[model samples]
Target: MQTEHDSTYISFSREEWASLHPSSQINLTQSEINHIQGLIGNLTNEEISKIYLPLIEYLSINMEAAKFSHHVKNQFLKKATKNPPFIIGIAGSVAVGKSTTSRILQSLLLDLPARPKVDLITTDGFLFSNNVLKAKGLSERKGFPESYNIRALIDFLSAVKSGEPCVQAPVYSHLYYDIVPGQYHQVCQPDIVIIEGINVLQTPKQVGSSIPSRVVSDFFDISIYVDADESHILKWYVERFKLLKKTAFTKPESYFKRFAELSDVEAEGVATDIWNRINKVNLEENILPTKYRADLIIEKSSNHQVDNIRVRKN
Candidate 1:
């Protein structure tokens, strides 16, 4: 890793980063890899070895340090060392592949020597339901920070960090395009939790000094931001929309069923417009501003391959 421009980050090229992988061989089976790879994501064994192995090595080291600190703290207080999850927050723009990255991390992290339990959750579930958004007139800004139930998200994180058992997180469905009422994913106190969302890195503003609450990112031991050129992200988003139009949107129960009737040309036009009006604005106004706050930044090429990595200097 090399420092440039007196920046807060130490940047590493793909090959340079790969050379730092842990000594022990770590193999991910083809089926496991296939399961982590998403429809819009590209990951091969080579990329894992090159881009992710070194990362896994780094995270393992940090996990060990966290355990040591916990042991030390508990010992000082004459208490047993209880498991406190090492929370990881992953932030990125829509279609920037954050979900795929989080899934890969969760899968690999679980296989470490301890065979720890790992849980993955997305901030999408924290988003307000369509009914709520429409009621608040934030329907056009669905992904914007204002559209989310920030208090609930932070409360859930607080519970997890405090080692609360069977903590439930709201469930969201892309088919319904909203949070499913009364459905939740129970998070049993795991060794690690990976929370992925565009809002993860954002530091919520404390308006008017109401009893200061712990921000969501504060609960994270490590934070990552997936980044790609806006043009590339725009293209990927449109392509994903087109694919969804043919598949998901065709389902009778889908909230976007109307989109299934559109011609290819019309679908692309609508997708591009949505990208410009909603996603582009959100990326520029909120998401991009928080990139520097992440502990690590994963830079992707136009082809969606991780090309460079930036780790914030200690």
Candidate 2:
């Protein structure tokens, strides 16, 4: 039988845990299980099993903990108050597999019997329109925090926290490199809402002596940071860029369509230049600085496997 680790004390090594379960037993149907198996080639069965099962268990436990805390607080106040929906923030450097992690977590959380209604939202949708960026002469700094409409993001979160029946968020297109007009994703009241982004844990910019009203982290019941060495991430970013150039960039409507026409040598150089100029700079200035704010950190090995998980003590 699986047992819950004590909240105040938890210790386990990857090797010891792997020895108990050499392979992951996927609970999904054959077809779905096959698809996942295809995605993570050669990963130990144990690693795959632990990926979702333990994750779902951990999240469920945390949600319950949040509820108990709220109950105690309400009792102390001698008044009734609605417990806000649990919000999770996921942050990582560019090309550090954050998107993949988010998708996996969403799937795991949704599969949980107790928390089947889980929603996943990405900060990409909150990014300012391309025209707006051009007008402000900030097109090159596209992924920076300033390029996003902070007020809109805050309002969306506020609505989610208030238990709104339906909230619409914009959808962004990677091929077009812009927000698709009139294409909004509607999120209903979910048991959990996962907000994944490169800078989700960043502190809110202060206006005056008064401490900044509320940083995005204020809304998060839990936060996770996917971490890896800078050099490894840079290499992954460049490789992913090359893959995109062959795939999405070939589309006529893609902003980077011209990249598809470049020779192999030229493409590598272009990918490197973009990594060094834009993505790397954003990683250094905006993303890396927020690492300490995460409640949990998943450090990736060179092979892109999660080798260590560091959880902040309460």
lDDT of 2 by residue, 1-314 (tens): 43332352233355543444445466456565444433332234345576545655667789999899989999999979777788999998988878767777787777676646778889999999999999989999999988988778888999999888899989998878899999998988877889999988888775456555767778999998888999888777777777777788898888999898887778879878988999999999999998878877777777777776656777
Model 2: what TM-score?
0.86
lDDT of 1 by residue, 1-314 (tens): 54443389888988778878745355767777768876676678788778877888888888889999999899899998576999999999999999889988887787787898999999999999999999999999999988989889999999998899779999999999999999999999998999999988877676567644567899999999999999999989988899899899999999999999999899999999999999999999999999989999999999888889999887
**Which residue pairs in model 2 clash with each other?**
23-45, 23-46, 24-45
List per-candidate RMSD values in Å. Answer: 2.3, 5.1
Work out the TM-score per prediction.
Answer: 0.94, 0.86
User: Would you list the C-alpha lDDT of every candidate in the order shown?
Assistant: 0.88, 0.78
For candidate 1, the per-residue lDDT at 100 reads: 87
Identify the candidate with maximal TM-score.
1
